[model samples]
Target chain A: MNKIFEVPLYAYERSSDQDAATAVRHKVIVIGAGPVGLATAIDLAQQGVEVVVLDDNDKVSFGSRAICFSQRTLDIADRLGAGSPMVDKGVQWNVGKVFFDNRQVYEFNLQPDTGYANPAFINLQQYYFENALVDRVRQLQAAGAPIEIRGRNKVEAIGTHDSHVVLEVETPEGPYNVEADWLIACDGANSPTRRMLGLDFDGRVFEDNFLIADVVMEADFPTERWFWFDPPFNRGQSALLHKQPDNVWRIDLQLGWDIDKEREKRPENVIPRLKAMLGEDVDFDLEWVSIYTFQCRRMERFRHGRVLFAGDSAHQVSPFGAMGANSGIQDADNLCWKLKLVLDGKAPEILLDSYSRERVQAADANIAKSSRSTDFITPKSQISRLLRDAVLDLSEHFEFARPLVNSGRLSTPCTYQDSSLSSADALNGPDITRPGSACPDAPLGDEFLLPKLAGKFTLLTIDAGAPERIEEGGVEATRLALSVKDDLTLELKRRYLGDATGAVYLIRPDQHVAARRDTFEENAFRQAIRRATGKE
Target chain B: MADLILTPNLDSADDFYAGLLAAHDGLDKSASDALNARLVLVLANHIGDADVLTQAVKAAALRGS
Candidate 1:
């Protein structure tokens, strides 16, 4: 709010050592200060890893880009120390209504089960989210965390080797050379790092472009995600309206492939579309407008020797589901712990391989889901459109067809079903908090299950004497005993343990299930650690 | 890989088969075959797994042979 639409230059003292031979080597250098990179830096710094972030741009993103922050992402942000402020500044929303032509076809509340601290979703401007992250990073830095965020420090060239990766950075001062033991390329969709290494995304490239306009108005619009397929306002085209934090509303109009980009983006053209969507009587001032065409694609491999990719650097998706940023945040969460352990020499470097493996799977899941939403929203074929309309018609009366009606199946955490880290357990458990799924957030005695389990290998025991925390082989584990007598523990048992009287659950640092056991077996804890880290 | 067709896939297999048989009871062989063809295509598209669908087609082609 302090600076409205003013893109200012960032001032960073030049640290470019002209001598290439004496360039300072960093432990981890993360490119891009967007949510994904900042999340990675924060996670690594929280774990005591010396991490530095390099962003080409100095100012916060101007537009209200990536407004829908999912609950899973908010949980991750909470761990990063920016969750509370984000919730305070964001417009919390959960319900979404999908309209077909002029009639409402489907409506859904992302969260029907409540009691979790964070809401199902929050509509926060990307700028505020980034600022909160920056503030958190500053606080951590002040508290002796070795995290450096260098804005206006643009990466010029990259060199990857077996031992280390070299990054040539450019600043207002001049171009300089630096190297890192590990370089995280979060440089976004047009990733210079990915291009430098000669990589390409392999997936669907969408044809249609979308015109996104953020309008500021005092009009009363319910805090619900309103999506339209062949909306009345813009005939035969899809439109979406979302309410943001500052009376600014985001309206995304689907511009067909044939439309001129220049003409479509003009305020004259956009305002008419807005007046149609929202009657001409409403007064509003245009805040920001941009055009975007997205592809549902990802790099086949997120990890390349000493270099790694996260966020838009690794994958890009259609915005219908808001999966891009959330999945990228998950990538950072999934990567940081593995990177930390490997950097500490606690886990085999193969552990880093799992980062690419798990994240690629997550990326594919996002791409698949997002692509389907895009297809359903903008049917590519006559048959597809007919089928979409049929589904819309059926969804009005039939409950079964509602799930099939896809207007962006809003992002949910990708459960790694085939993850190597997830232990192969024969014993059955409740599907709610099973292996490979993120630990379901339950209202624990005081806090929640996720916050209690994160940052360490936790052994959640039910109605059993918990094992002593065995810190061996560079592994640290804590065991928490839960009794069925306590209400919260009973709920935990119902969700996690099911009918098992005495059970042991091995949870990873990222709160992903590693292993579950009915009987406490000797060496199971350490073995789970070994399997999780891919050392076994 | 798709999940191999397991037990209890449908709540009432008997009722569904009864309805299927009734639907084709009065139809000619050509019309019944056409119906079967449409059914196969629709179910195949819903399954969406090419490998499993191919295996299924192979399995169906070899049934009772």
Candidate 2:
């Protein structure tokens, strides 16, 4: 039985003229109001781009889906101005414990290198995240920014062209024809937009079914990820327990592919399973019960002319490592800035092509990582099972084998190492700020490095030539000559400049390193900026 | 007894990864499996941490049978 999540109905006013033969032209129309779509909308609006989001549902996410928000996701969210609220409400956890057959094998801490802003991961319910993003979008709208989110607005049909994309949106009033300069599809795994366009979404599907249940209880479970392979509670299968906000504990039990999903989801079956794990004396109420068979698949290309696909619409993976939503959010972050640039006509339209290229590569990477996690969690073959056990066994003591332990690899942002936009770096420097990687954050006086470099094309330099005349695309280059006496300053030097005294780095608006050179010549720097913006 | 440093210890990580993958190239599933088994044994012998290896095997051993 599926219980509907109650959300305040948003009374949306229709913008398109039904009487007029032609539709109103919007700068961008984003389909689906899930994390990805909403993130895209919020990002575009932050860039002063007029954007609208359409979704079939009036409420936020039903269950506590995607509870583990990665540090990178939070960093991206904070950049979008929604990070503080989530961090405020979220359960910050970095330590994780992996078990095999009811015995603790090893404990690992993600993002051990400290002095940065955020933790490794935060466990917040998906609903809170969606609500926060929606609130931020509403705030931007109230501030007279061109952003509209229409709940109960569903995309029925989609047509793409070289010039623009057309959409038939079905609302409560009726069907309305609308057109957009570019259409972004974030309509989730079963994206009707992708189906309507007749594009193939190809990937591997695992045979195991995981029973995901969230139960509200006041328990003393520590804020850490607990993963068990063939636990006593669920024999011959794996189980995962994670702490979420509002005292809800997320329990995932591997149910095997042959189990009756309907019977498995019933309160009769679910309560016993929980009781078996948590003991019979404990009391709890089930918040959500769902079964998922994992699949790692994606479209060949995220873009088809003017229509762009993002989030689950573009690629989907097993929810083991919290990769699905995190990658989707990154997809939105990566696309929105580039889309804003192309829309503003500041750069060539080919910049949009890089969005698909980089993100498709990201999707493939996520799929590979997540699929391996899934295979480890639920071993299908005898050899796979044997290998998994061997790795887990060796992981308990040997630090070398510890890396083999895969409890969903945990979501991390993909660095576009092979990105076409990256400039050839002939300079001697550390690989930390390599072209096509997100610029590593370090303390700058009172604030962090990312916040300064974001929202502009920054030519970052540390202990390099004294930048007297700088200013290329939008902002001037930063010359950080802070003495390495400070630990943070030293870390910055080790990461960016390395053993060298100084290195000049070209950074994109998204804070990805576009190029790095020992000395920034005027012509070379200009050419690098142009290439970064898809002018090459 | 020294507390094992849990930080990055390897240099040339990218090259090592490429070599690792390249070593298994052109091999089918079973061959790759055999190779991984041989590699693990070789590495385990190289490590020679009996207590750690024992703890690891014991940790992943099948239970609740």
Model 2: DockQ against the native? 0.06
| Pairs that collide, model 2 | A393-B56
TM per candidate, chain B: 0.77, 0.70
lDDT (tens digit, per residue) of candidate 1 on A1-536: 55532554234756544455677899999999888889999999999999889989877778988888988999999888889999999986778888888788878877556657788788888888888888899899899999988878999889888989888898877888888999998888889989889987777566567899898889786788888889877777789999998898999988877878998889888898899887789999998999987766889899999999999989998887889889899999899999888988999898999999999999888877877887888778866766677677666766656777777877898887688888777346787666788877777767676787878888888776666686657887788776665544466767777877777888888888888888667577678778888787
Winning model by TM-score = 1
Return the TM-score for each candidate structure. 0.87, 0.86
TM-score of chain B of 1: 0.77
Candidate 1 interface RMSD value? 7.2
**Model 1 DockQ vs. reference:** 0.07
Cα deviation of A316, candidate 1, in Å: 0.9
A361, model 1: CA deviation in Å? 0.6
**Comparing only chain A of model 2 with the true chain A, what is the TM-score?**
0.93
Q: Write candidate 2's Cα lDDT for A197-245 as tens digits.
A: 9999886555468899998887676778788888888998888888887
